[model samples]
Target: MFETSLSGLLTGRVALVTGAAGALGESICRALARAGAEVVGVDLVEGGACDFVADVATAEGNRLMVAEALRRHGRLDVLVLNAGVQFVAPIPEFPEEQWDRLMGVMVKGPFLAMKAAWAELTGRPASRVLITSSVSGMVAEPFKAAYVSAKHAVNGLTKVAALEGAPHGLTVNAVAPGWMSTPMVERQLPEQMALRGLTREQVLELLLDRQPVKRLIGTDEVAALFAFLASDLSSAVTGVCLPADLGTLAS
Candidate 1:
């Protein structure tokens, strides 16, 4: 991160990013790649959108993911747990199965990934784990019971990892982003419309209302923050949840 430019900032480090099929994940992969890291992308689709494909939500799949990553690159310098799923519904009506799947993907998934990558990560002098938390992790919202809860768990996991990895010189952190202008966020508009009986524009406004900047976050913007966290420049910034929420946290 101390480099004069983004290019070659990562130099020889190798990064593994999950949920590479999504826009944000792909952008993150590209960003780290541009910064000179050999990025391996993991996704659910078989040979789909990333360098590697696997179901990150399962323990077996995560074990295999780390295996393949190490086989390919021989070292795991950075691990980005960005895979996620969303199911929005009022608490009273929220399906138990949906809650299970959401937590599986967002919480257990990262736990497994970290567990599998621990040896490889600690083998090196410096390593990083970057988890994707959300603004919902800090502030709760209606119809987002599962997401908020899982993100909150992610924050807890990040802090715990930071403590355990401190002696090993490994840093763990979370990037808590607000609503974004990505397809994943767009897909939720209809759900909101149906749940709240609001028009698409109205739903968008409501989602953006908390952010004084009044604009959806860009994937590239989040990627920049990830790059910083992945680099040595942020070595002193472990066990923290940094927000990329366009002034939302201010309000």
Candidate 2:
């Protein structure tokens, strides 16, 4: 249902994407590049797609990455906060450290990244900040207290940034995706199975039970949405968390 050619849509623009080593992040980097943007991939580790390695959960790391991008690219036009970490467990059973780590990566990371890139992004011809949220941000899901809470906070942050950026020609938005066929989701299956005392197939069934479409989402599908939001076509679309959930929220 997505258009194929976004070529030249973002020509001459520079984009910085966090979590560039991961599958979804890599896909986003590719999509943005295909759209003609000069994509700079950032991660905590090095990868083929990753250009810089830095922990985005800290203020200093955010500052360093932004500075490096500006140093290399000379300008910053797109910022994609796609870095994420998932820890699943009941609220009481969740580890304190894991909770802190999850919040740091998903919540604080985006906030700090945006803050660091604020000046560079604002007053530009067309600057965009796109966050990677999740369906958990829209609805509650069990065994994901930290993840759900972090995404909810991110959704709120997206709106606040959008409001502050509107007058400056800077648009801030987020993409909330549903179950995707990524290593992250694959890792969660075993945890869900053990927690719910279900088989692997049963756990998969349970994950898709709420959605009208009985399938996993593709990274490219979500990336396409991001590409659109990052382009001039979506200039009027800000402060919104668009879902790429395969009708999960619609149901």
| Cα lDDT listed for each candidate | 0.90, 0.94
lDDT of 2 by residue, 138-240 (tens): 8999989999999999999999999999999999999999999999999999999999999999999999999899999999999999999999999889999
State the lDDT of candidate 1 residue by residue for 121-160, as single tens digits: 9878789999989999998999989999999999999999
The local lDDT score (0 to 100) that residue 11 gets in candidate 1 is: 87
Off by over 4 Å in 2: 1-4
Give me the candidate number with maximum lDDT: 2
In candidate 2, position 155 carries an lDDT of: 98
User: TM-scores for all candidates?
Assistant: 0.96, 0.98
Count clashing pairs, candidate 1: 0
Residue 158 displacement (Å), model 2: 0.3
